[model samples]
Target: MPTYAIGDLQGCYLELRALLDRLAFDPQVDRLWFVGDLVNRGPDSLKVLRFVHDLGEAALVVLGNHDLHLLALAAGNSRHAKKSTLEAVLRAPDRDELLHWLRHRPLLHHDPERNFTLIHAGLPPQWDLAEAQVRAGELEAVLRGTDYQDFLRDLYGNQPDRWSPDLTGLKRLRFITNCLTRLRFCKPDGTLALTEKGSLENHTVGLVPWFRAAGRKTRSDRIIFGHWSTLGYRQEDNVWAIDSGCLWGGALTAIRLDATSLIPIQLNCKGYLAPGQD
Candidate 1:
């Protein structure tokens, strides 16, 4: 009955398995909550996708930016994507099945009973759990809907860098997608710094990490998120930052969600892509 929350797996399938084994993970009973980036940037995107997709109900995955990029590329929206490891996945016999399952994954997964919310990235300071859940649902509906191709076509952007209750249409969905999957630092007033990819020690001035925003609505809530591998595995201000740069020769981290105390278990990764390689 144990449950664990794992960090980004940017196609590090071997590392994922090693970490799982280190956790003594039992698929027959224990469950896994993935922070996403299940594919791309490493040597095993197709294998990673298939392994997680085959897990069925035993695994819960939130969509990450890389995951969405893979989807967009598959949707024919990637007219200019850079060199990517996702080619293996796209050429696989089960490509459609893998992509479909990935497409259906949510941007946010909240377990009300456990009072723990899982997101692939940061949340804007303006959104409380309720608001975040609603916005997440809206985006999820679009991604899982029939017109998803259209949404994918227009998904890449950093516009409308602020949240407004009146936002609608593509901008609204895109904003939601960004916060839930790509956010890192943002202003006090919830102005997003989507391009800020540096670690906390080197982030630009005037903006704070979303989890550190003084006015953050979900500050009192427990959040488990990845995406900022540079941020490493940190637990502070009631948020867990677990993407410990597994794809960059760091570690694949995991926390026991059902534990009485927070303890991170990690598996060292053999250096894959170097920094800035992606």
Candidate 2:
């Protein structure tokens, strides 16, 4: 049995299927770990959600920013900022069931036996695998609980960008949320730069990709993450970044995680949306 970690789908259902075909994947004997953003901005978000949801125990997932945005929209707590391809999913007859399943997904996943931690975006330098899991649980409790709508309403902020053991309430939740789903770069002290969507080499000073931050606690553990399409495919510094901007004319990628070597299986994508659209 093989377990593959896939990149952000962003509703590119056909590309996902194509990539799977290239892998010769069999759900009965193979498992999948999705790095989130399973829907948004592509042609077949509803189909993608339905397909992944029906996979049951064969698929494990962490929630991405777009996935959370869809949930927030379903909860009537947030509006789509620009273009959104999630309306069909929201209006589907099985919308409630699908959204319910999605809402319960975690922000982080760590396979202790394999020693691989999976997240949608990036982790702050401050946390080790243990603290990361705990903080993720804190936010997960709110999103999966009855007060989910209230938290969703307050989800779209950049305050409390720096993580602290002293942080509490919504502020704490928001900071954790940003780091897990939207983080790309940060200062050495783990101050998150949520707005910096460009690549790390874009002449930015004093800000490094989260994995490159000094004294990162999880530096010794392998991490597989997506959500940084602009950063492209990276497998350095004990971290693997698999988001290849499939919705933005890049390729959809999947890496076999349990294998001793890393060679990404890629499927070229149609330019459904231009770069920077997201």
Candidate 3:
């Protein structure tokens, strides 16, 4: 009856396995909630994807930015960025199934019983719990429907940096996707600054992390998210930023829902990626 929420994997399968073992995770009894980014970067992307897929209902995963990138790449909508590392997943025999599963995973998940909200990235400072669910559903429908490819094709870029219900077409979809997956810092006006992916110290003036927006609105429920590797494991009563960059020589982190404590397992990511990178 234990439930654990884990941070990004990013193809670090050995670390994931070790973390699970540290928790003594029993698929028959415990549930694992993954913050996503299950592939890319480190190594063994294929193994990580396959193992998670095999876990089935034992695991709940929200799509991360990297996970969506894999789907888009599979659909021929994306290309590898510099320092990209997803070849093993792309070449896996089960690539199609893995990608399909990833594409269908929800953009946002809420558990009322636990009073917890899960997403790959944090919610916008403006959205309340209801708005988040409603908007998430809109994008979810598009992602799971015939027009999914169209959504993926227009899923990049930083235009229309602000959220507007009236924003239409690809611009609209891309904005939503970014907010849910890759968002970090934003202007006081709620416009996203997507290009600034550096640590907190590297942030520019007039731009604050999305979670710190003043006079902002989002669910009062606890939100758990990954994607910001620099933030590491942070908890502030109702907010959790658990991505510790295990693929980058950090530790894999997990939190128990019943108790507000976190369990961290270190990784020897040496030689997992290019030398000196991790």
Q: CA lDDT of each candidate?
A: 0.90, 0.89, 0.81
Error of 3 at 126 (Å): 1.9
lDDT against true structure, model 3: 0.81
Estimated TM-score for each candidate: 0.98, 0.97, 0.92
Candidate ranking under lDDT, highest first, comes to: 1, 2, 3
Q: Once model 2 is optimally superposed onto the true structure by TM-score, how far is the C-alpha of residue 71 displaced, in angstroms?
A: 0.7
Q: How well does candidate 2 match the true structure in TM-score terms? A: 0.97
> How do the residues 222-249 of candidate 2 rate in per-residue lDDT, one tens digit apiece?
9999999888888897899999989899
User: Residue 195 error for model 1, in Å?
Assistant: 0.9
Candidate 3 stretches greater than 4 Å from native: 81-83, 260-278
Cα deviation at 277, candidate 2, in Å, is 2.4
* Cα error of candidate 3 at position 87, Å: 2.8
| Alpha-carbon deviation at 200 in model 2, angstroms | 2.4
Candidate 2 lDDT at 115 equals 82
